[model samples]
Target chain A: MSSSATINRSSAFSSPRVGQRNWEYATLYIFLAPFAVLTALFGIWPIAESIRVAFTDSYTALSDSPVYVGLDNFRAVLAEPAFHSSLWRTLVYTFLSVILNVSMAIGLAILLAHPRLSRGRTFFKLAIFLPVITPDVASFIVWKWMFNQNFGVVNQALLGLGLPPFAGVTQPGSAFVTLVLVEAWHHVGLYTLIFLTNLQLLDKSLDESAQIDGADRWQRFIHVTLPQLRPAITINTVYALIEFLKTFTVIFVITKGGPNFSTNFVSYYAYSKFNSAQYGEATAIATILFVIVFAVVAASYWYMEKGDQR
Target chain B: MSDGAVTDQARRSAVRATLESTVLYTVATAIALMFVYPFYWMLVSAFRSQEAILSAPLRLIPEHLDLTAFQTIASIGGTPLSSFAFNSVVITVLATAIGVCATGLGAYALYRNPRLPLFTSVRYSFLLTIMYPHMLLVIPLYFVSYKLNLLGSTLGIILVMSLVPLIFFIFVQFFRSVPQEMIEAARIDGASEWQILTLIIVPIAKPVILTATLVAFLLNWKQWFPVMVLSTGPETYTLPVALISLNTEYGINFQATMALSTLTVVPVVIVFVLTQQRVMGSFMAGAVKG
Candidate 1:
């Protein structure tokens, strides 16, 4: 009864004052209006339009009207051998890249966070992260040069060591491996940073208790530290999955979906379709890719939530 | 146990610790080198002649500084380097400025009225949109821009780029931590919401603003896919697009491409170096909180 009376008294005191400040609503709306309009136009509208266009026989960007063709676009896209290969390639690339990236990230995070290795923490962090901040096109272009077949530094180093020359984006056989490596290098830093942040926030007392209970470093990490890192692991896995699945910039710069379509992922494939004025089919591919990404992300979230409950 | 045995164990453990640190340092240094070597190579290659860059027994360091590649890029045919640089600057600046401001305002509005049904829905919608990949929007956006007569224009790019959902989320997160009592006090003092936001909130939120600005700047500056699809002509091409053209047009001129890449990268790198702490802090904030 006393708490209810206090709440009533506070509301009584503030209600009239807040009532008099009606202009605040207008100001707030004014502040929000531009962003809301822009989001609706560019952010929300495009998703809706893309889905709509996927079911239509739209060919050109300038076309005012496109005939609705139901699932024809999807059917056509699904029947194509190129689409099937690109989709498979995308999945394979995404799987390899995500695993490589997340593991490297975990390793680097642990290395950087180690107590004994105090010197040059900042240097290592900065060096790893430099690529993340460097303009993507520029860095990818530089990587392309570094991986050049005849004039590349990579081949030079390998040949100097009296080893057989590594094929760097020149041949179909090794292009996928090259793509994975370059993508991992470009992306692992951000994931590492994420893991490092999580590590810093971990409860140190749990590790101390494990140590006291006769757990060795590996056992403690597996039983205690790794559990604490579950959230970071989930986040990094999902992020890297989405990132590599839709990988475009690297392919655009390095391979252009070649050394004979070895590195042609789905995004680049859809881009090629779009360039050829197969708008309907292109949107269908995009819509399919979107569904896959959304479904995977949703599933991961659900799985993580279930894991947390346990 | 005897005191001598205890001392012996301590010394042995210390030696082992030293060995562990040595191994960790070696691994860390090697990894850092592997990550950083490409950048080092890029910088050096920019200043080397094409022949020197491709020569046998590749020199890690350039023998002599060469300005020919940089000069060549500066005056390449009909579309010069300056135009591309100018387009990039204009697009990045306009997009980041408008993006950061609009995002800040929207976030503030949501933060101030957390209970309002409309604002709550808007907030949730923004959160949901972040899940959709950029590629999914490209096709429709291209058509939309065409319909709106915004295709092949910087205006369209700026507007589209400014609709960044992540920045909005970041701003909202930052604002939520701000004490409500401060805003209430300002309200009671008859300071308008606009005044409170401008005078008080923005000042307190400088770090978030800087972080968002840096992110938006880098994103806009480096954007290739959308810009590539949207731009129909060389005149509208940004640095990245122009860099691609340079490669295709000149038929794999590594020296010139390196110089152009250097131009494109140096500004962002300099900004990043200057504000490294805040950028890292922002990433931590997003990771931990979001």
Candidate 2:
């Protein structure tokens, strides 16, 4: 019904006369003025300004005048060993975090899809989804406390189990690992809900036929259920990849790029540069990250479109 | 003999079903508990004394009712907690209301008048903003804010955050579902396009409005990064910023920090409790339907 309305509307729009078009366009401009103005100021213009700033030595505090430094800022950012390692660390963090979080979401979605679990569905859903909605700073604060070396419940639990307490956030390696875990915990619920909704809406007849053909549950899942879940997988993977790539608050609150900059990702690196008032350098790093994210999202979207064609 | 064997196999499958269900329930419960325990601990620890919090043996239950943490948070560094709370409430409410109005009206316009070259171009620009990485824009936004003299003001924050493409996209999705007949009737009744939107369309799209409002509210309430970069001092800080600054100012006071954290979290949880079902359902419905 809606699709047909859309078609009819498009036909009407395409056939509208030129003389009357001005009046219609005028009305639309009036309606769109607010969004257009805001987007220009905050979104488009700033993006344009970022590109301009990326090539110049611009510092807000140091000087109002920006010197055209050509590719010096980009060259400096690329040459820094810190930049390379942070980029690598960010990739590793995103990779591990996406895998863990997406798998956990799928696992939980499968469990929640159980017919027998319907009675307690809302309880579990809200319990898991609560973290996704909570304020980032507040949630990070709690988790930071949870990872406290001396009094954190995690270390306490380890001690109770008769193993030595790990310096959770004080060390570089464990701190990075801890960050990945906390991030996954904070975000997995959203993907779980996404996958869960997709799962519940699945056409059950395909799986039923598979079962009737003497396929075991695992076999049916592998052959029928998994293939049908391509759309959800695409959505989850794209979203998770983008999210992990832009991770900031958890690191900001807990590690501050921590013991030897082990947990420093590109986002935090850009932020730290901004903290030092190196606007050109900061925007350069940000531009690099933006291109990376854009490429990943575009690639995934293309892959999904191809899958649909298949 | 074949019939008997079939019955035995059916019984065996039933047992297996029950076993799998039990395992599923147990795992689900454990995971929920694991996710929820830290929040539970945050609540319990807020009322605990500092020593009780730091003691070797962890106490799941509060040993005593202590108000020191709450007291400290209320009067920390001569800034009243109410001031920060008031700032957050004002910022969040204004941002949500303004954001919904802007996006809702704009989306309705786009939906009602499609394929107009100019509007289509503008619509695509908004959509482009939706996918563009915001990190790159932060530096330039700061520069823009500095030039416009909007750096330290709540209204500035509201303006910057409210015109976001996410809300616009959500509104566009919902507005697409609005039936055309209703608008045509309004038009024939001598109503203007604005009247059609305000009088006919908005009343029918209450759920979308609510969903957008809730999401914008959540996003603003939890906003800390922009506040950190844009706002200058304690006077302009929101609740989340205030809590972090308090954490920094008063280190080793976990009790007070937790108390402040709980206080910072209370309104969001209250909002969530009131509208969790509608909000979650709307989000899932929107994503799935799209």
Candidate 3:
């Protein structure tokens, strides 16, 4: 309230009344300088450099300057069977993980939002959200132990359930599933919290009105509840998509993109190339990833804006 | 079609309600356990011997607690565990402090001057970067650090990390929730813009600011890729990198790895436990409102 008054007072004091606009501009510029300078140096410049490097045959071993062998890096990346499998795997990973993660989060959020469970809300929230705050590398390493082929708790539990012990990270498909499960576990807490917040904000009167209209619990949730949580759903969907797309740490630590590159995500692929000093090829992979991520996010935002108009 | 039949239906409905409530409590408790069990396991495993950790059917309760893994960490590389922790603390604290201040001030400027060209472009650019993952920049960032001679330096990590786009967005969301009248009131009292931000705005915005700080701290604390790429040696390594090194150097020493993992997560867990309500509330409020 006071901020609006200050804004009006300042605006009124501007121009002939007081000449403060120039001062305001100067201060604004100062406030924006750190962001601008850091972003230009690290963010924008690096992005541009990656694009430029993508076209050349740049590698650390080459003494000569990078030649603009246009399309060669991209061509090479496309030709590699490794690249093909990895790209497909990454897409599948993103699609499945986002669906499972977001839906589970919503379910958990709804359960936690129940009025009957109010007494344990903090404990439940803290427990669920704990993983999201834990160090990713730490959690990944611990999960690696949990998924260990011989001594993994998961397999041990399976064996206890009268099931045969199966290789975890040593296999192809199972490795992917393990990675996805770990990823979902690490992330669902955050989305659940987001959904919980939106759930709490929902007008209960609307739910009551639906109930009065003879809608059952499931019907009320599907009809009156889900539609109202669109903003949170959109946010979570895009966030989960982006997060899954750039999932490198878990795959890097647990599998190292092994078991025939089953879990070889694009980001990890790029990092591996970079490690081997294949700078041009790595940047090309990164550029392709950048394009895909940009398109999806932009399209999602556009779709949401269109929905808002209706 | 009598009163007896109506009573029977009412009793059935009551029984159904009880059954439903029981199911809800059961499912919710199970999910919470699944979420929290791993950390509990990690803590327990950290205190177990190598034999205990690798036992076929893992024991939820160890026969005896052992700290050999912690002992290994304590004497690792002739540098104490505290040194790695000290390095992590220094890096995370400085980066978070600088990052939070820059993010808050930048968001405030953008919030106040919504239509200004400089502010608008910067604001949108941060959003654009949020869409583009940081993996794109890591390689070039390595080169950038090398060219600037910031490699293997704490200052370099702090500088690069202080520009995190998501934190910027979080701050922007928080500032948007701050009513303009707050600033207006401060200005009407002959307060400068800086004074307004410091005196009137920041105090009211403490919760979100703290949330952002916690997030910034968490990111820096858990950061691996940047440190892995930029740091040249152990001297400059943060806790995450050190933990990774512990794993690689020790060769499947699950006990030590678990112990180190526990150590790595302790500070963050402590901070989260202490301020869980305020931090989570502030975080969600920003998202919900904005």
Candidate 4:
């Protein structure tokens, strides 16, 4: 319905008018004025100013006039061991999180979409998706409390089972794993729903033919079904990657980049810098992250376009 | 082959199928539990006394329904819970309301004047902003706010949060599906553009409006980074900020924090449950189109 509507709308829009009216032009700007002004001020202007601030000696947030110091902040950030570790940790976190979230989503989508599994599909979906809609801070705080070293229910449960208590976010080694788990728990539902929607829309004849050809379920899935799900795969992967890269609130609430800074990703690192009144370095770090994210988005977009052409 | 052999094979296959389904259900249930158990614990802990919450041999259910946690947070000296709730409501309502109007009007303009070069560029520019990391924009926005004297002001946060690109795109998508003929017919009958929009477009686009409004409200309500950065004092704190401050100040007052978390999450969960279909539909639309 929407696609056909889009087609018709585009065609009608392309039809040449005799002449564009003055009032139409006037109405266009008037209608657009609020969005335009807000976007310019809050959207575009900030990005432009951020890039500009990266090169200046604006140490304080209240600096009225900052002197130009081209590349100094960038140099300092690149040279700092803390920034390097944060960047490296961020990359690792993004990689792990994307893998976990995308795989979990695909797995759950396949399970829920299975023809034999009819009962409780809605129950399973609602359960998984509830966390996605829950307020982030509230949920993370709950997770943090649950993972408390001494009194946390998680440790208590383990001890009750006559097993050694697992160190959740209290130790550096397990903190990253715990963070990824919490992040994946909070996010996987959305990606799962996306994949599930695509799965339902898929043509089932291919799978049937593959089955007739004596293909096992795994063979059918990998050779036939998985190939058809490329678009959803790309979308979920990119979205999850971007989301984990900018992960802040969870770390802020749960770990505070503590237990030896194990979860101090780039976003939190930059935020900490900003909090302590180091505007130049913070924005520079932010600028670097922005460039990296932009490159990833552009690359995936190009990949999708190329795939579409084929 | 004998008929008995065939019957035996059929019975074996049926049993195998049932076993597979059982395994599938068990795995699905466990996964679902992992996602939902924390929320359950939060609710349970909220109703338990502080001692029970911290006690060993963890109880999954509260012994009694305790109101002390709620009372404690409510009566906490300096910046009561009501103030935080008030800030959240005011910010979310103002931002979502203005955001829907601005996005609807702008999307209508873009939809109608798709041929105009300026509008085309403007549309692309709005889309382009999505590629930038929010932190990049926000880091500099802190400076922008400071310079404009909006650093600690709720109005500043509302204005910043209102200009959502995703909402704009959703509006544009929905507006494109509205029959252009209705709009044109109204225009031909001497209805002004504003009249055509409010009377013709708005009524027809109620579902989209609701979806956009709900999404905008949720986004603004859960907003933490911007509010945290902008607000200088506790007076301007939203629920999320206030909740965090409570944690930091009290230092593991389990009952109170859980109570606050419950208070924060219950309304959102209720709203989501009531409008689950619409919310899910909007997300699917956004995801597929995006």
> What is residue A272's positional error in candidate 2, in angstroms?
0.6
In terms of docking quality, model 2 is acceptable
Query: Across residues B152-245, which tens digit of lDDT does each residue of candidate 3 receive?
Result: 8889888887775557757777676788887776666667677777787888888777778887887678887787788887777777888888
What does candidate 3's lDDT look like per residue over A95-131, in tens digits? 9999999999998898899877877788888988888
Chain A TM-score, each candidate: 0.90, 0.91, 0.90, 0.91
Q: Tell me, what's the RMSD of every candidate?
A: 4.2, 4.6, 3.8, 5.0
Cα lDDT over the full model 3: 0.81
Superposed Cα deviation of residue A58, candidate 1 (Å): 2.9
- List the global CA lDDT of all models: 0.83, 0.81, 0.81, 0.83
Q: All candidates' TM-scores?
A: 0.93, 0.92, 0.91, 0.93
Residue A229 error, candidate 1, Å: 0.5
How would you order the candidates by TM-score, starting with the best? 1, 4, 2, 3
Return the clash pairs for model 2, or none.
Answer: none
Off by over 4 Å in 1: A1-22, B1-7, B115-117
Model 4 DockQ (Cα-based): 0.51
Model 2: per-residue Cα lDDT over B179-222, one tens digit each: 78877776555455555667777787887788888988987788
Question: Model 3, A175: alpha-carbon shift in Å?
Answer: 0.3
Report the C-alpha lDDT of model 1 over A168-261, residue by residue, as the tens digit. Answer: 8889878888889988999999999999988998999999999999999899989998989988999899889989989998888889999889
The residue-by-residue lDDT of candidate 4 on A103-142, one tens digit each, is 9899999998887778988878888888887889999999
Q: Give the interface RMSD of each candidate.
A: 4.5, 4.6, 3.5, 5.1
Going through the candidates in order, the fraction of native interface contacts each one reproduces equals 0.61, 0.54, 0.58, 0.64
How would you class the docking of model 3?
A: medium
Q: What is the DockQ ranking, best to worst? A: 3, 4, 1, 2
